[model samples]
Target: MRVVGNYRNPGPQDEYSQGQGGYPPVSQPAPVRTEVNAGRLWAGGVAAAVVAALIGLVGVLVARAVFQLSPKSSSAFGDDATVQLCVVAALAALMATGIAHLLLVSTPSPLSYFGWIVGLLTVAAVVVPFLGSGSLVVRLSEAVIHLVIGIAIGGLVSNAAGSASRLTLGENR
Candidate 1:
């Protein structure tokens, strides 16, 4: 008998052949299962919120110091635009994280769907300011700031989803 890989070539007089000259079949491995780590996902969401707040703060600072621009005050947002922007940005980040989590569990291509949703939202944020009553420069500044915040939140949440996911072969189906 000769051994090759996992199969053996039985000789003509081999007793194990029992009138059948065939090798035993090899079994296939089980499929891999993927699971999400909620803790890591939330941690990334918190980090994304912090980043969004910082971006908001910097955006306001640059607009004020560099361009000598002042935030327009309205009854809806009150006098402190910086505070509002920061808080809104933080909340937006958290919301984005939730959306990412939902898509991760429900959608087939979660990342792709998340990207499209975020991109569309970012576009809406940028466009909404232009439609409102405000100076071109102020609107442009606000739009730019919103654009940056949206991008940061999206990227962070996506990365978190990827990191939080675990793959195991034949562990849990």
Candidate 2:
């Protein structure tokens, strides 16, 4: 018998000539399953926090030295600007990482949703300072700081989610 296709000669049990077959049926490979690595996610979170804190520190320095603006808090307890900004940035980074982890575990498309969440939060943070009774320079500086922190958190965490995951194939679905 002549084989009409590129497939190798069929075996005795193969039914290539059953009906409209040119070659034996090919079995499809199994789908791959991906699992996230929690340790890498945590490392990314820490790195993001450190970067955000540095950004906040730089913002504070620029506000004070370059713009000649002093940031004042509306809270009851007077707080050091540098310390408060850095702490808040770090906390925000950690919070973003937690949210990212939850989304990655629960949702199929984590990055898209995470981006929306971080972007909206960043907008709110920027707008919040404008509503307060701060000088233009202070408001602008705070907004910049918030923007930088948001970028760091969103970019780093999403990248981490990709890097920390492992894909396993050939497993039964």
**Local distance difference test, candidate 1:** 0.84
Residue-pair clashes per prediction, in order, are 0, 0
Give the per-residue lDDT digits (tens) of candidate 2, residues 69-108.
Answer: 5436523222476788889999999999899888777776
Candidate 1 residue 97 C-alpha distance from true site, Å: 0.9
Strongest candidate by TM-score: 1
Candidate 1 per-residue lDDT, tens place, 1-173, comes to 88887667888767667746665666666765557798999999999999999999888887776677754653322247778889999999899889988877766778899999989999999898899997898899999999999999889999998999766676323
User: When superposed on Cα atoms, how far off is each prediction in RMSD?
Assistant: 5.3, 5.7
Worst window of 10 by summed lDDT in candidate 1: 70-79
Off by over 4 Å in 2: 1-33, 70-79, 167-173
